[model samples]
Target: MKVLGMLYGMAVGDALGMPSELWSREKVKSYFGDITEFLDGPKENDVACNFTKGQFTDDTTQALLILDSLIENDFIPSEKLIAEKLIEWAVRTDAFENNILGPSSKAALLAIKEGENADILTRKALTNGAAMRIAPIGALFSTAQNKELSEYVFEVSRATHTSDVSIGGAAMIAYAVSASIEDKSWEQIIEGALNIYELASKKGAETFTASIPERLKLGIEFADLYQDDEETFTQKIYDVIGCGTMTSESVPAALAIAYYAKDPNRCALICANIGGDTDTIGAMATAICGAKYGYDAIRKDWIDTIDSENSVDLKNYAHFIELHKPQFKGV
Candidate 1:
């Protein structure tokens, strides 16, 4: 049931933040004040301007593709398979031949479309695209060993973002989701995620900025200092950790928000308020929080809105995961 919450949380966060993506923190604050409901994107923004209120963007769409692939394969699908599905998705959604795809994913998917090997194509790529769609992977293999989980993270991530930093970011999110589903304590979850980051860093994964583990630690400290002050906490997130599309910035920021918010709705709201790359951060943070809090924690209105607007079947996804749990027992 909590897995259902995690999936819906991803969609809710994605929809809640859709309008605020790419806006600066000040611009977001000045415009929305505090985004507690789904809103349409700015007319001037090409990427999301066409979307209606409560519509999720590519984050949820792509993650759903990964989820479908997992259900079909009964394990982590191969890079080639995932890459092919991405291209098919792009074509179906008209994201192909348009400038709608993310930098890393676009490059790798294009390379695969042109008959290049996915692994070779993504060897130097790094972006949050892989991490954005990784929650399903975590849910599918939550019981796997760390080494096995890391291997699966690398495999799926290499389809679009093969750089060590990108892979590391995906790994941490995957591990965190897995830990959250297992009902691990917040401290244990953070420690496990940080350990994964450290291991990936040691393996020469390239990072876009400061260490993610370091930023996460600092973010937790800031959260403690501003427990009762949402305004200061938000500003500090922008000032210290950042909230960009880069893996280093967004991944840690999402984790930090999850740690601070502790509740799925608050996590999504905070991510929406933080502005840049809000959809991805909100999706990531709220998924973890949802895993902790369960499906009942989410608002029914938001879930209904997402379903009606996006035509997604949240209960069907939950049933699929439940039915396929046995196949992943020893993985």
Candidate 2:
């Protein structure tokens, strides 16, 4: 049930924030005020303007590709297979030229299409695309040891985002989601995520690593302040940590918000209201919160809305993850 929550939570957050992605905090406030429900992307939104209310964007769509690839390959998709599926999805969904794909993913996919090695092409690319689609990997491998989990995170992320920064962001989200699914305490989850981030930082991009611990600590501090004055809290987050698409900024922001909110709906709202990269941040935060609180934690209305709008089956993805979970040899 919680697994279902994580999957649906991703879509719910993605849909709720779709309209606001790339908007500035001031612009978002001027327009939507505060996103409490699904809304169509603004006419000015170049990428998402074509989407209807309650329709998820590339975040969930790409995630579903990862989910399908994982299930079809029995939990371990090679880089080529993952690249093929991503390209296939882009073409099939007409995202190839729709300005829908992220810069890093678009470049990597193009490189793959041109016969470059997926891993080599993405080695320098760093974006939230990998992290946005990483919840399923976390949920499916919740019980694996941290070392094993980190390895899997690397393998999955390297298919399209090879930067240590990007991989670290994805690993942090993955470990947090996994820990939440295992019902670990919030402290434990945070610590586990930090540990994964530390390890991942050692190998890849070194840009964001040094500041993560401080950012996370700041998030906790702000969470305490959030209860006193919501407006000030939001402003503080915007001014300090940011809500942009950079893996460093958005990933930590998502973790902080999820840690602060601890509830799926509130997490989604916080991410949605923060502006840039709203859908991706909302998806990451709400997925972790959903893992914590279960599917029932999400608003019934939101679930119904997403179900009516999107074509993919959330439960089917969850079921496939469950069915394809790794079988440990000497557990």
Candidate 3:
């Protein structure tokens, strides 16, 4: 159920926030008034216009790609296969032609498509493209294997986002998901995320980006201080913590939102209305909440909507991850 929650939570959040992707907080409020439920992607927004109601974006697509890669290779993933899969997806879905690809990922994939290595393009890449799709890595491995989990995080992320900032952000989210799935309290989960981020920061090329761990700490502090007021909480998240494409901005913001909202559906709903990289933040945050709370915590209507909307076999991936971990097997 935890695994299912993580999987479905990612898609649910992604779909719920799809319509408002990349809009400003003010723009989101003005256009939709308030996103209480999934709405059709407005033609006015550039990236969001590609999607419809209850449809997820590249965030969930790439995550499921990683999940399927693991499933096909007997639960082992190789960098080569993941790259191949990304390219295949890009070609199949015309992601390059469409506006679905993230900036960092688009650059890296372009290099790969041109018969070149992605290292140069990825060397300075720092965006949530990696962190957004990293929840499965958390669920597939337990928090006890923190070192091993960080290594997998590097492998999974280095293709597109090779900067230390990017890897650290991705590691933070992944550890949060793993810790949440293990039923750790939110406090302990934040501690684990900060620790793993420090370890994972040493894996990739260093960059001039903001520190994800430090920003995550700040975001959590904001959450704690603004807990009593929804208006101030969301404002702090949007204006101060930021809701941008940068891994450092969005990843920490997502973690903070997860800690603040506590509930999966609320996390997604808040992200949906908060604007600016809404789908990615929602996907990352809600997945953590879902892992902690289980699938039952999610709204039944939302679950059915995701199932009916996306053809991706979320249950299969969830089942595979559940069986992969020893603790969840035969439950």
Candidate 4:
């Protein structure tokens, strides 16, 4: 149930955000012309993620595979397991079989194939790829919330995302989700993550808080730029956030959505609208909000629209694995 809550919530966010993945706020207003309720694909966007209307992309797929690997291994993950499971899941799905791996992940996997040191290999790459697939660490370690757990989650990320910001972002999100699962308030989760970030390397608590409003303004401003031309919404925000590469832009952009959106669905929709790494930010926000609010909080219609073969199976699989989780035995 805990697993389903996280995975399903993530897919809902991914699918919801897919339509307006790169649109700015004003562009979204112009595109949807309203957007009060759940809407379909973003108009004039020729991207594949948005091509299928309300659908999920790699973020949810990688995350679901991560959860599957952890559950299959009894919550203990290693570099080899992660690589193998990712390739396996991708090949089975036909999405990644056509050679569609994310840039950082592709590099990391190639390094693994060459038998390079996992630590050194991870440090060499600091893409959002690591943070993109890190939601399961939060769910798996939801029970262990102290500094010890924080350290373990950091180590879990270090195996793949060794850069300061990359690892810090993953750790922060994991801590927030785990803390939220424990029923902490939104402020509590954010502050807890801020405290962790402050203690770990260059990521400061004040920096996190200060970045929020700034990023939100950027998103809103980028959105406003498209008031005249909805067609340029994706490109304009992509220019602002530059969805091409780097975990810094992707992680923080995703965090911005969660920070502004307190509600589960709202967070998904808002993050999706922020653009550039739309699926990633949307997926991350969904994981955080889902962990906080549970599966019951996400709207049913959004859940229904997800790509069933990939999305629904993952949710069911995650839920089945959650049955043996000791913390959830009674609840």
Highest lDDT: give the candidate number.
Answer: 3
TM-score, every prediction:
0.94, 0.94, 0.97, 0.74
lDDT of 4 by residue, 23-77 (tens): 5555655766544344555447644333465557677777766666666866665
Count clashing residue pairs per candidate.
1, 1, 0, 3
Expressed as tens digits, the lDDT of each residue in 197-255 for candidate 3 is: 87888888988877777888888988999899877888988888789999889998899
TM-score for candidate 1, please give it.
Answer: 0.94
Model 4: how far residue 296 lies from native, Å: 1.9
Q: Which residue pairs clash within candidate 1? A: 164-205
Residue-level lDDT of model 2, residues 210-283, one tens digit each, is 36667777876887777667677777777788788878778888888888888899888888888889999999
Error of 2 at 14 (Å): 0.6
Candidate 4 collision pairs: 22-275, 24-223, 25-223
| Global lDDT of model 2 | 0.82
lDDT of each: 0.82, 0.82, 0.88, 0.60
Q: Which ten residues in a row have the lowest lDDT in candidate 4?
A: 204-213
Candidate 2 residue runs with Cα over 4 Å from true position: 117-121, 203-210, 326-331
Best by TM-score: 3
